[model samples]
Target: MTADCKGTVRNLDRNEAAGASLQASGQRDQVISFRIEHTDEHGDVTGYSQVELRGEVIYGGLTDGDRVEISGRKGGDGILRPSRAKNLSTDSEIWVSNRPGVKILQGIITVIMLLAFLTAAFFMITGISGGRFP
Candidate 1:
């Protein structure tokens, strides 16, 4: 079975840090660091794992206790190859918004209901005029 590991970006080199450093002094800035805690299935502490992700102003800054999900397979070197990393914050918002189409769907449903009602009323009137019902 593939084992899943969770960790956070300890060192983040982003544009924001450069800008901050430039605005403050002429010295290069340090990368952002995060402390991540992970555990194994047996409830054993997996120790502190760190990752350095390079980007423009870390998309979602990792906090001290941010929840993360990692999926990967254990390699022969006793290390995990993380194939996927997900942050709780961005994951929730990564969904298709159906709000824009809701009005269109509502209108279609209303038209269908009106047509059904009219058809029923027409059938009742025809039945009454043709003496099909007493």
Candidate 2:
């Protein structure tokens, strides 16, 4: 399912030096996330939410105090993965997921695995029929 969430960016977590260290060590796939605080009409803090984006998201730079609207589908784990996010304050937009290239890569991997399995099955059948397998 899909959802749209509007809130203020209460904090931006860039991971700072810790992320940099992990990047240098080739283990930088950890997700970077920010906190969002929601308020009621009375300007009273109501609730809070979180938007977690993958490490590859680099289009829209979010900052504290940026009002944002995130639209995306929810995963089985009930996480709202932002396919697109708009920063109302900066008028900037970013795509966080559902990338075409990523989908294509996954398709290619699936095809390769299927082909490998078919080839192995064919060889096994032919060998067994020809008495090649003792």
Candidate 3:
């Protein structure tokens, strides 16, 4: 659909990382929360209920209940034909995993300390052999 499909933004079921793969060669649908109301002929609210939008939703933002637009071709699935989707908000929190970097730095420091201890032992052994001790 070329038209801008407006829907409330909601959180995804998965914990995603920053810059992670969001789209793949498959049908994707997202869940959104919104209020649904039925009006009578006199324009009076007859009924209302909370609704969840489940269709081909693209990863838009990180917050729940954020408005978004989905644009793209729908696969064979019965959901909306979303070729691409973008979040309406620019301010979204992206999470990144940095434990690997911390682990690497710790390993380097450990190796350096081991090397320093070995060098000091070598010097002490040589000095004792050369009768340099008082």
Candidate 4:
């Protein structure tokens, strides 16, 4: 399960610390030192936090010592592969593509409804024409 963490950046990579670099994927990936307060399931502070993370999207212009909130799953390599992040200082939502495309589903449903309506209309029109006038 992924956990939400809020903290300040402690250390950042020298490359991204200075400026964001366009990567081969065309998405700017930057590593940030996040000082988040870890907690257990019982809501107790664990006194441990992820020292470093590569989660911030480049649009927020994250840098060293910037406050941020990130959410990710802890991997077997002891690294937090965050999927979403936001800059606390600027309150900007950086990454959120994990949940979208509902429009396609809705479009499918709409087509079904339209087909049903058209079938009913066809029956009504044919029945009215064939039946004797009252």
Candidate 5:
């Protein structure tokens, strides 16, 4: 049967730098599991749950304390077999997880911070910047 859950990553089921699975022959594939606090449809946290997610989830940058939604199925052995995952935080929130490559906004932020700092420095040198130090 398929199952779904939404919640924060409480912790890794065990200690390891990361996880991986071996493909046919000798190729390696990474696997990660997270214990979570399941939430209801209205967003109220319902209870605890666990999932074993496969693949490098696109837009799925997972980290501890991150809230996520997962979809998968339960095996006959009672283990949760997750096939997909997604992050559910907003733009204003700290994205603990991202697809990869630092973050989607990293480049944008570089330009923004550079411009802000340069503008502030320019105004400071010219005594046109707003603040209490003038």
Candidate 6:
């Protein structure tokens, strides 16, 4: 499931920090940060918040003071992952894509672990049948 929110860009410091780390580690990644401003039924500001997005900024060039509407899903880690963002100030939009290779590697590792467990179970069963149990 996903949710939507509207807010202004508080800072792009996360991107800068991530960029520096990526440079040092020879990795490619970026984090987008937003300060979500909550509103009441009367269209008045009620609260403020912050969210981080793990993906590349594909367009529209987000910056401070840009009003944006973001639609995204909250990951299992309790981080809000943006799927798309529209910069109302620039009248432009940006789409986000999480790195696919990481997910693929996770699936592969899970399968390997399952197979290893099954192999161990099979050997144990065979050993018991051969009078090597108890």
Best by TM-score: 2
C-alpha-based local distance difference test score of model 3? 0.46
Ranking by TM-score: 2, 6, 5, 4, 1, 3
Clashes of each: 0, 0, 6, 0, 3, 0
User: Residue 39 lDDT in model 1?
Assistant: 68
Q: Give the top-scoring candidate (lDDT).
A: 2
Tens digits of per-residue lDDT for model 4 on 30-133?
55454565557786766645644443333345666666777778777556666567878877765523222454676788899999999889978777555575
lDDT of 3 by residue, 30-87 (tens): 4443333345768676753333334333333445555455443333432443334455
lDDT of candidate 6 over 1-134, digit per residue (tens) = 57778876775555543344342224556666767677787878887656676553344477777788887787676556676788899999877665577667878999999999998899876775654566
TM-score of each: 0.33, 0.57, 0.31, 0.43, 0.48, 0.54
- The residue-by-residue lDDT of candidate 2 on 45-125, one tens digit each, is 898776777644356677889998887777776666675789899999866543558657878999999999998899886
Error of 4 at 85 (Å): 0.5
Report clash pairs, candidate 2: none
Model 1 misplacement above 4 A: 1-4, 7-30, 70-84, 89-134
| Candidate 6: Cα lDDT at 128 | 58
Q: Rank the candidates by lDDT, best first.
A: 2, 6, 5, 4, 1, 3
Q: Which segments of candidate 5 are over 4 A away from where they belong?
A: 13-21, 39-45, 55-59, 90-134
lDDT scores in order: 0.49, 0.71, 0.46, 0.60, 0.61, 0.69
Runs of candidate 4 with Cα error greater than 4 angstroms are 14-48, 51-57, 96-134
lDDT of 2: 0.71
> Is candidate 3 or 5 superior in lDDT?
5
